[model samples]
Target: MQNREQLWLELPPMSPEAPRRLLVFLHGAGSSPEAFAPVALAWQLKFPGAQAAILQGPEAHPGGAAHDWFDTRAVAADRAERAALAAARLAQRVAVLQQSTGVDAERTVLVGFSQGATVALEMVRNRPGLAAIVVAYAGRLARPIRSGERLDATVHLLHGEFDSLVPVVHAHQALRALHASGTEATLDIVADSGHVIDQQLIILGTTRVMQTVFRGRRRAAGDGRTLH
Candidate 1:
């Protein structure tokens, strides 16, 4: 269970009243908000004007003292329903953040790792357009997304080719599911990588967020240039 004293870790934006983007990060099983807070902080440097929130799972991870979004030991059939519930709760949390920070769904991004990614993916089904983009690392769908339940946000699925913990096949399956549902999804396989987030994945995530956040915007005539 989450420690009532510390529910989440947050990196406030440089400008509380105005910010360019927001990132919501979810940690893997047996992990706490602390596990992903560093990366979330580092993103401030990478994205320049973004705030980040590292959310802790509501339930305690069965493996240890860390937290988990859903009980990993639950029957496979029940896992999906549990994940759906988690998604609903998380959407409410995100709404609070959005209201307090003024970062709407259009300017926010959802990023998750492993089991956390599964819950994030579930959120896409539960609340479409909850964010502009979602980046899932070393994760897969806990259950298949049904037809007519299309995800509205752009999704980037990254997995290590040599990831033994989750296996790369899961990424492929997720890609198929998202594509079938007509979501804008991309599957990027990192060669020789393991079930871990590396510099490459971080850069890719940053770039994707920037791209989605700035897509279709017109720059001023005098503007030198932008990465996009």
Candidate 2:
């Protein structure tokens, strides 16, 4: 992991006792750390006593009023390269924080939206055991994943079926890659949503994590499904 520094907002654990879990949040492209704070808080509230952190993208978005994890102007493959760089730095930060909080990688939960979500998935693409679970929304796989590629994180991909910016097809493609890599993953498509975040999606994400990450249960099957 790269040792480059990244900005982070820490929300101390609700309890002073030793926290066993760490939650990390990343915002979408052209979105700020503040804009994603509420989503982080909601997840934290659902998982009591877990420490949480919100990471801000390093550069400002060219469009203004926000930030981006990588340069969007770059071509498809180049964009993935940029996202990989950002993911390396963010992974380093998370590792350092985990040491301080006494939370191991298996107890870490990484969540992100859009661009941030891509980087979140990238974190575990080649590095197994970085995070126990990853919840990515409205994001595509930045890198090509081959069959049997090492990945220990159980990923939950959530997307809007009608998403125009990043078509739901991207999520389906990612799921296929994940499956080929023999990774444990799931995809949920919301029927009545677009590119934007929907409350129902958020609820589904948290619920999914709570069921598998915390409760150690498995869903019936490993196929993608549309949610009404």
Candidate 3:
């Protein structure tokens, strides 16, 4: 087992002893925990009672100084297998995080971007109960869910409308698949957005986290479906 403690930038809660939720963020490919520091800081500031942990990828990027969850280029056959291995490791890390922070699965929110999002989805599928909500941006499902598989989390997929890299269609596909499998999932298509995260998307994600943590507001009145 890997020493997962050395793999994160842990941000403690602002209000000590007040029940805190855990926010675990996984960065995109070729990025480090440092690269995501600003986002983590913003999230902490927005929700001071929430504990944040920005994690680094397990493997070094072949191109240079950054890191990757799994190989993106070449080895088409083993891509899914490799991604699954990475997700399993992340699951272990999440378990450690929950134990250390004293936060339960329902109060934990797992977040990921791009390749990280792929791994987050896989983590939920392979090892459930890490979180009740998953915020995946610019990513897709790692593999097809087998028949009778169950996903207990509420997944929120945010994708840029003009994303050429992964394409918005992937988000749609994930939403459909998750719904078909009886998973609570929603998709938010950002207009005029590209492959990057913007302020609007950040606010949206933060709001969702608040709603989940507080439980004051329901998912609208009439329909159970989220409109966004």
Q: lDDT of each model, Cα atoms only?
A: 0.82, 0.83, 0.84
Q: For model 2, what is the alpha-carbon lDDT of residue 31?
A: 86
Could you tell me the TM-score of candidate 1?
A: 0.89
62-136: candidate 2 lDDT, tens digit per residue? 969688888898676688778888998878888888898888886899999998899999988756778989999
Our model 1 lands, by Cα RMSD against the true structure, at 4.0
> Model 3 scores what on Cα lDDT?
0.84
Tens digit of lDDT per residue, candidate 3, span 79-131?
88989999998898889889988888877888899999999999999887878
lDDT of 3 at 154: 80
Question: Candidate 1 or 2, higher lDDT?
Answer: 2
TM-score of 3: 0.89
Q: Clash pairs of candidate 2?
A: none
The numbered model that scores best in lDDT is 3
Q: For candidate 2, what is the TM-score?
A: 0.87
